[model samples]
Target: MDMVNPIVLFVCFIVLSGPVLIVAGIIDMSKGSGTRGGILTVLGASTMGLVYWAYSAISHMNFSKGRVLRLKGRARVARRALGDGWADDATPDIEGLTPWQRTVLGEAWLYSAGMEHASVPAFAKLSLKLSAMGAPSELLEACHLAALDEVRHARRCFALARAYSGLPWSAGMIPELSQDRPQRPSPAEGDDWSRLVRGSLLDGCLGEGLAASVAAEVSRRASDPVIRETLAVIAEDEGRHAELAWDVIAFALERGGGTAKQALRQALDALETQRSPSLPSIPGVDEAFLARNGVLPQAELGRLMEECIQRTRARASSS
Candidate 1:
């Protein structure tokens, strides 16, 4: 799941351009070269069709901007949390891989890094909002730790991206954000309770739960030992992150009661609409190749996603 890099999109569009051929074919026909013109016209129409397909696929295969970011009106990756103690010394084994494989893997990790980078602030804000609601110190502490873990996750993915692509990409910067707002985080208030519940249910529990499941599958499928090991570590961390989300929901339900339950139900109902559409067919990223490189191919990813969503709903209902 790579971010649709605008630069790549532009390059692809140019390479797939059919207008020039079409226009030339029209000119050739006006000059009495009907045979050549007919051939060119047919080729041009076919090329145009291919171009349309490519554009559709690329647009549909957009980035997985995590749900937490979406809840806060920060759906786009902010590219903050600059380079520091983010990467590890572990080397990703990229030997014997085709150039396209390397690229597919690199972009996958790069997109993941962006999502993880966004989570740092997401957790920080969660902590602040919880604190405003007079949440327990343990919950606050977990939020802080989760933010740190996201920093580590982003670093690992960034390191892997650089390793696979030989590109010098870093999480852009760390912005200064003040968590001290004048607003009271009172759980007694209806609006506060609803916001807290919605955030915990949609962003935390559902989002992180799905993330953990997907990472586990990716880890299981990877043939590259180093990549497998890296994802294993990440998958384990994501499981804990999902637990923390549930913990938040648990606390919210305890204090907010029926109001919280209603919010949870509303959030659960919204899941179907929010579920990502099936990924489009990507170039050089077929089912077999992606599975071996720690990436779920489109079909596998779709199935896993449905499973995760169903599991999340069951868990949320019981909780």
Candidate 2:
């Protein structure tokens, strides 16, 4: 069966349901009844429904007959680092995959999952920091929401890893909630506001913007429907995250005065010399397979990295 784009479906669901919920909530509130709460509850339920719907739609979109959902629970596996420095816990059961392919897929997805998981803590910290800095409510909300989005992205990537390997995987030991906070540079090292702006420039503007571009390009080139679908969703979310980063930077510059701008410029200059490392080619694995599975070739990756740098530079210069 042909599958509609999960993003398109999600947008449609949001557009169709958002107004209905708002109208119903307004009507119910007008009657002085508790129906407003009910409407909000329904809206929440509908959003969850949409998430599941999109998941199912993507799962069924691909022609692969392999089982896609054999694992149990919320799919929130803990991330673990192996002795080889790889963040992997389980071996996949995918048949016909070369050892190189397995290694590539496992390592790639594990890194992706790690980043997603890490983003949860990153955003949470950002939200707290922004709040303490007296940022506007909208920015605070965006930071919190971005954290939630990262959680979803982690699960989604983990699911993709499982699908590729056809094995139930684990990330090893789960840590306490308090231990999950991201390790951020302390204000003792430098000015707090400067650190914040620099972090935003390096992580949000440069890192996420580059990731969005790569994800979008990979989505276009991916032959596997499921991989394409997953990358598409990631690309959209990452683009938004980048925008949020830029927005926060703008806000900081507006309020932070010369110190913030100087810090941002310095960070950009420091990052300018950093370049993406090229992926090593495996002897037997075809580039086609790698690309199909969401890995861009060296040439394409280099181009994307250049584009990201240029875009970030442009934004910084214009600011």
Candidate 3:
């Protein structure tokens, strides 16, 4: 009994189940029994089945995608660690360690920041994928610009983190981030409004809001002038990003009519429901930093949601 074989079998089972349930749903919907009770039963069962199938399918796909990314990321890390020629271009040099070991520690923090900031570029790529769903070319360009800004911010932060720690830092210290795998859109893909709304919620509302919160905290906590200034600049850029996201969402919603409004409301409600009571834990990131600086409470997860809602509502009122 190969352990890996069972995992592969389980994946196959999920793939089969997803299509089967979807087909069954269509059959149930097509049945014209001309009876209310039968219709209701079919409707209820099929709806439940579809929902379950959809959730499982998405979870499985997301997991598989994440695994592939991790594998590729590990390869990159290994190559860098092995003193590969390509690594030098991105890696930074560490100077003499401060007596306090702050240089090494700061490097770690900045490493995490770089990875997180990599999401900005990741999202820009996402915008390219989203282009099929009526996303404007300008919006995609903005995503690319935002990604560049994030990369700049990450580089600056990493350098400062190294400098403050009194470590010798140089270029090529960090490696490129792994890319998220390609995802195929479903049959319901043509629903442009839903796509825009959801993307806005995730990218603008959640991502930007969380960034702003983190930046504000970074600005508040650092005792060093350079670190403080670096954080301040990042925070200012993030603020603009968040505002730009809101503007994009509002502009789209205004032209989309009642159906779009309903979709927006539904998305917002869904976001509210999905809001967590605890903050997301990222590797090497300390909750204490956030807590100490008047940003988000370590255990709280709704900072982005709260901020998003506030921003969205304000936009609505003014419009």
Q: Candidate 2 lDDT, tens digit per residue, 148-259?
A: 7776776666666654533344345445444443456465434767877877877788878877888888889987676787788778888888888899898899988998
- In model 1, where is the ten-residue run with the lowest total lDDT? 58-67
Could you tell me how far off, in angstroms, the CA of residue 210 lies in candidate 2 after the best superposition?
0.5
Clashing residue pairs, backbone N/CA/C < 3 A, model 1: 81-173, 86-155, 132-185
**For model 2, what is the error of residue 117's alpha carbon versus the real structure, in angstroms, after optimal superposition?**
1.3
Q: What is the C-alpha lDDT of each candidate?
A: 0.70, 0.65, 0.48
Better of 1 and 3 by lDDT: 1
What is the total number of backbone clashes in candidate 3? 15
> lDDT tens string, model 1, 30-126?
9999989888888888777665554455333322323355432346465534355556665688778765556556667777777888788888778
The better-scoring model by TM-score among 2 and 3 is 2
TM-score of 1: 0.74
Best candidate (score: TM-score): 1
- Models 1 onward score TM values of 0.74, 0.66, 0.51
Q: How many steric clashes does model 2 contain?
A: 0
Query: Can you tell me which runs of candidate 2 are displaced by over 4 Å?
Result: 1-78, 81-96, 172-189
TM-score of 2: 0.66
Colliding residue pairs in candidate 2: none
Tell me the deviation in Å of residue 222 in model 2: 0.5
